[model samples]
Target chain A: MKKNKSDLIRYLFFLSAILSIALIILISFFLFKEGTVIFKEVGFLNFILGKDWSPTNTPSSFGILPMILGSLYITLIAILIGGPVGIITAVFLVYYTKDKHYRFLKSIINLMAGIPSIIYGFFGMVVLVPAVRYLFPSNGNSILTAGILLSIMILPTVINLSEVAIRAVPRFYYEGALALGSSKERSIFKVVLPAAKSGVISSLILGIGRAVGETMAVVMVAGNQPRMPKGIFKGARTLTTNIVMEMSYASGVHRNALIGTAVVLFMIILIINLVFTIFKERNVNG
Target chain B: MSKIKIKDFNLFYDNFQGLKNINMNIEENKITAFIGPSGCGKSSLLKSINRMNDLVDSCVTNGNIYFDDKDIMKTDVTQLRKEIGMVFQNPNPFPMSIYNNIAYGPRTHGIKSKEELDKIVESSLRKAALYDEVKDSIHKSALKLSGGQQQRLCIARALAIEPEVLLLDEPTSALDPISTLKIEELLQSLKDDYTIVIVTHNMQQALRISDNTGFFLNGELIEFNETDKLFTFPENEKTENYITGRFG
Candidate 1:
């Protein structure tokens, strides 16, 4: 009788686990069926490398190179700004701050993560748009403004993960460095931080995924120009922003093209996840 | 000549006393081993020599530790540690290359030239008797080495700083007999150039390696004497009981 109940519980867990995988497979099947349809109208090579995206023009061109470049460039800027700040802030929290202040500082970072992305988008539109406008004299929605906002959005993720990685390094390494007469900063940077390298790099990888997949916050500030980004200050549309901005008004082939852009975005994130897994594996062995 | 002098030392962790008043003179160019049961404050006293206990917030010491006739507590901590190196119980080689692990101490002291670092690395590894085993793969990660070799690499790393004294806290407690014998032989050779102090749980290790031995029980120093004399003819009843494998 007990074995019967245990078997039932095991089946319930197995069903829940398989259900998530089934849903993912179903979604991927639909996405591929719809996404590949647009390739029939616009040749695959032309669609990927095409510099222009005019979905509503006469015989609309379906090139998405500009959106890909936009995604790549903006994610670069966010990593540049957020990566160092988060890693260093984590080092400070783990090595420098006392228990009392560390708790308070940790909660503030957690609060930043809890904020909704749409609220962040609203903030970028209201404050960052005007600030950039005052500086660059454009309507203020540009690649730079969106990138800066996204960097802030990724900070909580980078800091929290980096902190966990740095904290996970055994205490003995730090003490060993100190015993060699290394200073506090030297011990942390040279010994403690290096020991936590794989974990720290994984944190940045996760941050890049977050920045690349961001759509709603980016669309409001990127100006949706659909042109190849000429400079940091110029307006642009990322692969993600392109989909969200056009999916509402898009129809037929145009709607499929938006989904095709998603397929590209999905590939980018999949590659990022693959790199993350490889790193984690190397960390275990090496 | 004395390498270190501890006078009327007492250590407290918040309200709890960790070590009672202790006084001892550690001779230069000799191996001094502290032996005791667990939690007997021998490790605490050894940590005090290098001011390592300063890392503990609640730890307080009332005493003077004189190194080369200068006050140790008043010396700058970085400078103190540079002159007095340490090895821990567990082998902790920084996750970098073996060459880098050995060079890290010298580099921290502002030695930048690769030529000088190569010299220091080779010499320190030789001093720790670990060069020939790791010379070909010196660039490989230090963590890849065997446990005993890793501990020797740590010793080589401590030697790289050219410290006048080395403090070891139960360094061989985790090692097999062969590795323990190798370290004992290495210490015999090292005493000509470096002042060595070790804390041990194994009374046999103390007899085999150390020139002088100090026995402690319940945070108090019960006896300090020559290793041969102390183990063969312990003056204190508690010391005899501990060394004889008869516990009260």
Candidate 2:
């Protein structure tokens, strides 16, 4: 009787484990099924590479090159702003911070992760927009604003993961460096940091994923201009923002184009995760 | 010449006494080995020389540990460590290339020129008896090396800074017999230039490579004498029992 009950529990646990994988396969299958319809209507190359993205014109053209570029630029800028700050904060938390302060700081970081995306968007709209407008001459709703907002949004992910990675490094490396007469800071930066290199890289990749997939905050801060991003100061439209901005009222080919844009975003995230997996595998093997 | 002097030294982790009041003098350019059963303060005493015990949050020390004439507790810790290097029981080469691992100490001390660093790396590796084995694969990750090679690389890393004293904590306990013998031989060669202090569970290891052997029991130094005399004719009953393969 005990063996049978245990076997049943084991089977249930296996089913629960497989359910997530099955859901992912099903979701991807449906996404591809729906997303490919637009490619049939417009050539795949044209859909992906064309620059003009007018969905409501007399003869609507669906080119998402601008949106793709906007997403790339915004994500790159966000990583630039957030990556170093997050990593430094992580180092401070792991190595330098005293035990009493560590708990307080850790709670605040956890709170940052728990805050909602919509709240972050609202914060950008109310505070960041006015601040940027005052600092710079432009209308403030630009790629720079979006990048800054996204940078803030991605901080929790970057800092938390980097901290964990840094902590996961074996204590021996730090001891080894210290025993060789290296200062605490030197030991951490040179030896401990290198030992946790793959984990840090993985954290950055995850941060990039968070930045790319973010939609609500980017929409509120970015002016949603569907043109090539002129510069850091100019407004832009990301693939995510493009889909969310028109998904409510878009029809026919317009709707399919948005879904197609979703496919592109999905592909970008997939590639990022693939890179993360490769890095993780290399860390394990080498 | 005495390389280090411990005067009424006592160590505690929180309220638990780790090392009892101890007094000893270690000579320069000689290998001193501390042997005892597990958790008997052999390693604790070894770590005390270079102040590695400072890493433990609750660890407290009383009295003096003098390196040369300067008290180690008062001297700048980084400077003290540079003067007194250490090798752990487990080989802990940095997760970097073997060449970089050797250069880390010099780099920390502000040697930036590539030629100087290269010379230091070669000479340090040679001193650890690891240069010929790792010369061609200098750029390879130290983690890729065998257990013994990695331990030797760690020794090379410690030697790179030209420390006056080297503290080793059971450095060969994790190695096979051949690797253990190789390390013992390396330590033998190393003692001419460095004051070597080692902690080992192996009585044979202590007898073979050490000039002076200190037998510890329950956080106390039971015996300290020349290795030849101590192993062959122990003054203390506990030391004799331990060396005779009786209860530790």
Candidate 3:
């Protein structure tokens, strides 16, 4: 009787494990099924590289080049701003900060991760927008503003993962450097940081993912202009922002185009995750 | 002449005493061995010479350690460490190429010319007796080397800086018999140019390579004498018991 019960429990657990994979497959199937319709209506190249994104006119154009450029630009700028700050902060936490202060600061960083994205959006709209307007030449809602806000939003992920990576390095490497008469800073930068290279890189890549997928906070700051990104100070719309802004009232080909936008975004995420996995595997093997 | 002198040195980790009122004089260009059971503070005393004990948050030290008649506590720590290099119990070559690992110390001390670094790298590896084996694979990652080769790479890394004294903590304890013999022979050759201090659990190893031996028990130095005399005729009962394989 006990053996039968144990077998039933094992089968149930196996079912639960398979259920998540099944859901992922279902979601991907649904997305592709709906998303491919736009490619049929508009050639894939024309839809992707058309440059013009007019969906409401008599003969609408459905080029996502502008939104793609905007997303790429925003993600690049955000990583540029956030990557160094996050890595340096992580290094400080692991090597420099004392125990008591480290605990307190770590908790604060964890709390930052938990705050809602809506709250971040509200904060960006009220605080960062006005600050950018006051300090810079452009209006409150611009690519620069969105980039700044997105960088802030991605900080928690960058800091936390980089910290874990840096700390994961064996203590002996640091001791070895010290034994060689290297300074503490030299040891950390030259030995410890290099040892944690793949981890730090993955952190930046994950941060880029967070910045790319961010919608609510970005929309609040970015002007949502569906055009090619003009300059750092000019307004633009990312792929995510374009979909979120028009999904409510979009119809027919327009709705499909938006879903098509999601497909592109999904591809971008897939590439980022692929790069992360490659680096992780190399680190493990080497 | 004495290269290092420990005067009434006491060490504590928080409130727990690790080394108690230790005093010793280490001679220049001689291999001095510290033998003790586990947790008896032999490694602690070795670490104190290079001020590695400073890394421990709760570690406290009383009394002065003089290197070349100058108090080490008052000297700049980085400078002190440069003068006194250490090898850990575990071989920990940096996760970098063997060539780069040797270059790290010289680079830290501001040697930037590639040709000069190359020369130093070759000479250091030669001194550690690892050059002939790893010469063709200089750019290969140190982690790829065997355990004994990695330990030798670490020795080459320490030798790159041209330190006056080398302190090793159970360096061969992790190696097989042949690897252990290789290291013991390497230390024998190194002692002519560098003052050597080693912490070992093996009494036979101490007798074979060391000129002087200090036997420690329960955070105290129970005996210190020439290795030949100490092994043949121990003055302390505890040292005799330890050397006789009676009890730790």
Question: On residues A166-242, what C-alpha lDDT tens digit does candidate 3 reach at each position?
Answer: 99899999999988889999999999999999989999999999999999888888998998889988889999989
Best to worst by TM-score, what's the order?
3, 1, 2
lDDT of 3 by residue, B35-84 (tens): 98999999999999999999999999999999999999999999999999
In model 1, how large is the Cα lDDT of residue B103? 94
Q: When only chain A is evaluated, what TM-score does every model earn?
A: 0.96, 0.96, 0.97
What TM-score do all the candidates reach, one by one? Answer: 0.96, 0.94, 0.98
Model 1 per-residue lDDT tens digits across residues B24-82:
99999999999998989999999999899989989999989999999998999999999
C-alpha lDDT of all candidate models, in order: 0.92, 0.93, 0.93
Q: Candidate 1: misplaced stretches above 4 Å? A: A135-138
Candidate 2 lands at a TM-score of 0.94
> Which residue pairs collide, candidate 3?
none
Task: Highest TM-score: give the candidate number.
Answer: 3
The sequence of per-residue lDDT tens digits that candidate 2 reaches over residues A1-286 is 9999999999999999999999999999989889989989998889989899999997999999999999999999999999999999999999888899999999999999889888999999999888989999889898989999999888898899889889988899999999988999999999888888888898899999999999988999999999988998889999999999999999999999999999989999999999989887776764
Model 3: residue A179 alpha-carbon error in angstroms: 1.0
